[model samples]
Target: MKMVFRWYGEGNDTVTLQQIKQIPGVEGIVWALHDVPAGEEWPMDKILDYKSKADAHGFHLEVVESVNIHEDIKLGLPSRDKYIENYKKTIEKVAKVGAKVICYNFMPVFDWIRTDLFHRLEDGSTALFYEKAKVDDMDPMELVRKISDNPDFTMPGWEPERLKHLSSLFEAYKNVTEEDLWSNLQYFLEQVIPVAEANDIKLAIHPDDPPWPIFGLPRIMTSQENLRRLLKLVDSPSNGITLCSGSLGANPRNDIVGMVREFADRIPFAHIRNVRVYENGDFIETSHRAADGTVDICGIVQAYHESGFQGYARPDHGRHIWDEQCRAGYGLYDRALGIMYLWGIWDSLERNKQEVGA
Candidate 1:
């Protein structure tokens, strides 16, 4: 697995490329244009600009975390055609910059849902937390306000420009059902997979954040069967998955190791992280260590290795440790440590193989 790190561009992020470079085996950054609205073409000059920065740092620009899907596409509106064309243009632009994969999600309104951004852990470190009961109890706007109230930095997915229309956005999806979402996603993949293939860029859809419906919105990209259906939509190698452990693992039945082995060839990108799932349906992001969380970090890595994966992977959301004043769940300290933990698993597996062969 070729490891990458998520970098939210130059000034937008607290973690620096210099710090990222210090992490062993991290080869590139998973990035995006935060200011660019969905459905608009990504500017060519801007794409090359990030390319220049990556070149300067000697880091590969192999994967982008998201080129968000326009809501019209998910809603199956007529305007979605224009948005698909724009997405094709964006894909072409990212390809020019040497990107091999573009990771995007199809969740209706919010990209990822969480009740608390800095939920304190027993060890005093804090991580992203999702409270099941809270999601059902709070108003959607109230939840949005709570998450966006952070004064430190503007949270991703909760962009003010987008959330400004939260009511309308949620209203747009009221009539849409799970089958409708699947059909819309298929329509989208049908249009874009050819473009992605032509550009040698794999279009990887991230699994639904909690692998379930939220706020009465239909979420189809939530399970293995749905994933299988997604691939069959395009029936091309360019059509694939991001294979995020934390996102799909929230359900406790995802069998991440099995998923990795099954979808190995289709997955060109991975979001490797762990989460502690409670019997109450609440969940919290945890360290990459196996013992610290429910997801089998070691087994997942071994499955990727055994599958002969030559794809890009990254350490996903990490705890805020050492009192790091950074983005919620994206502090450099824990993530860097998580990188070492993942690398330890990967490297140890390779060493074990060599020793056995010897």
Candidate 2:
């Protein structure tokens, strides 16, 4: 596995490229032009600028976390064709900068949802927390205010500009259903998969953050079966997935290890992290240690090793440890620590394999 780190950008992130370089085994950055609105083609000069920065630090710009999908595309509006055309152009631009995998999601309204950004854990370190009750009971607008009012850094999915139309977006999605979402996603893939393939880039869709519908919004990328259906949508090697453990692990039913074994060839990127699920249906991000969370992190890594995975992997989300005031889930310290833990598991598996062969 080729380990990578997520860096927001120069001034937008607290963690620097210098710090990421110091992390052992991290060879690239999973990045995007966060300032650019979804559906618009990314500026070629800005893309080159990002490439230069990473190249200066000896990091490959192989993976992009997202080229955010326009709500028009997801909503299947008539304007979607324009956005889809722009998306095709964006794919070509990122590929020019040496991006091998482009990670995007089709989740409508919100990309990811969480109740508390800094929910304190038993160990005093905080992490992103998801409370099911809050989602079911609280108004999404209130939750939007809580998430979007941040002065520190822009949250990936909860961009203020997007949430500014929360009510309208929700109303627009009221008539949309799960099947409708699947059809819309298929429409998107049909148009863009050929562009991605032509660019030698795998278009990997991130699973819904909680792997479930929220605020009555339809979420289709939530389970193993749904993912299988997604792969068959385009039926091309370029059509792929960004398998996220913490996102699917929230439900406790998703067999992440099984998914790795089944979709190994198609997955160009993996987000390896752990989350502890409770009886009450809430979950909190935890250390990558298997004991710390419900996810079978060890087995998941083992599955990748067994499959001879040559794709990019990253320590997805981590706790707010050492009082490091940073992005809610994208901190330097704990993510670095998570990387070491993942390496420990992978290295031991390699050593054991060598021993068995000997």
Candidate 3:
């Protein structure tokens, strides 16, 4: 596995490229043009600017966390064709800058939902938290206000401008269903996968953040079976999965290690993070250590090692440790420590393999 770090870009992020460079084993930056709205073609000049920055730091711009799908595309509206064409253009532009994988999600309304941005842990640090009861009981507008009101850093999926039309967005999806979502996603992949293949960029769809529907939204990329169906939708190598552990792990039955072994070849990107799930259906992000959370991060890494995964992976999210004031889960301290933990497991696996061979 090639370790990468997520950088939100120069001024937009608190963590600097210099700090990211200090993290051992991190070879690249998983990035996107945050300023570019979904459904619009990314400016090649802006793409090259990011490329220049990463190149200056000797980091490969191999993976992009998201090129967010517009609601039109997910809702299967006619305007989706224009957005789809723009997406194709963006794909071609990023490929020019040496991107190998583009990670995007198909979740409608909200990309990922969390009730709390800083749910305090036992250790006194804060991490992103999801409270199922609150999500179900609270008004969608209230949830939007809580998340999108943050002025310090922009949250992915909860863009203030987009959520500004939360009511209409929800209205647009009123008639949409799970089957409709699957059909739209298939339509998207069919049109885009050929372009991805041509550009040598794999399109990896991130599973729904909680691997379930929220606010009555139809979430289809939530389970192993759906993921399998996703790959078969287009039947091409360019059609792939991001295989996020924390997102799918919320359900406790995702069998992440099994997924690694099964979709090894199809997954070009991995979001390796841990989350502590409770009996009440709440979950808090935890350190990458398996003991800290419910996810079998060790076994997941082991499966990747055994499968000889040559894809880009990142320590998906981290707790805000040492009072670091940064993006909610994109803090530097815990994630760097998480990277060490991952390397410890990966290195031990490598040693055990060498010993067995000897």
Candidate 4:
């Protein structure tokens, strides 16, 4: 695995490239222009600018967390053609800057649902938390406000420009069912997969954050069966997934280890993290240690090792520890710690493989 870190760019993020460089085994940055709205063409100069910075730090610009999908495309609206064209252009631009994979999601309204951003843990450190009951009782807009309430940094999916139309967006999606979402996603893949093939850029669709329907929005990328169907949509290596453990792990039923092995060839990017799940359907992001959380991260890595995964992987989200004044789920200290934990597992596995060969 070529380990990467998510950086929000020079001015936008609290964590600096200097700090990221200090993390052992980190090779690249998973990034994007957060200021750019979905369905818009990325500026060539800005893409180059990002590349220059990462290059200066000796970090490869191999992956982008998201090139946000246009709402019109997800809604299957008539204007989707125009946005799809923009998406094609954006893909070309990112690939020009040496990006091998672009990680994007199809979840409507929220990218990743959470009841609290800084849910306090027993250790007094806080992490992103999800409460299932809130999905039913809380107004979607209120949840938007709660997450965006922090003026310090922009939340990835809850952009004000997008959430400004939250009520109408929800209304637009009300009639759209799970099958409708599947068809729309397939339509998107059909249109863009060719462009991705031409550019040699893998378009990795991130699994739906909670892996379930949130506030009645249709979610299709929630399970292994759905992923198999997704791979069949394009039937090309360029069309792939960014398998995220925390997102899929929220639902205990997901066998992430099985997924890592089954979809091994289609996966070019991975977001590896652990979550502490509860009986009440709530979960909190935890340290990468298996005992610290419910997710079988070690087995997942072993699956990746066994499958001979050579693509990029990143330590996903981490708790805010040592009163780290950083982005909510992304703090320098804990995530750096996570990289070490994952590296420990990967290194041991690799040594075992080498010994067996010898």
Clashing pairs in 1: none
Q: Worst 10-residue stretch by lDDT in candidate 1? A: 151-160
**In angstroms, what RMSD does candidate 2 have relative to the true structure?**
0.7
Off by over 4 Å in 1: none
lDDT of 1 at 261: 87
Question: What count of clashes does model 1 give?
Answer: 0
lDDT by residue (tens digit), candidate 3, 210-326: 988888889998888999999899999999999999999999988999999999999999999999999999999998999999999999999999999999889999999999999
lDDT of model 4 at position 281: 90
lDDT of each: 0.90, 0.94, 0.92, 0.92
| Model 4 weakest lDDT span, ten residues long | 132-141
Q: Name model 2 segments beyond 4 Å from true.
A: none
Please, what are the lDDT tens digits per residue for candidate 4 over residues 100-190?
9989999987888888999999999999999888877988878887888888887899888998988889889989998888898999999
Model 1 scores a TM of: 0.98
**Scored by Cα lDDT, where does model 1 land?**
0.90
Number of clashing residue pairs in every model? 0, 0, 0, 0
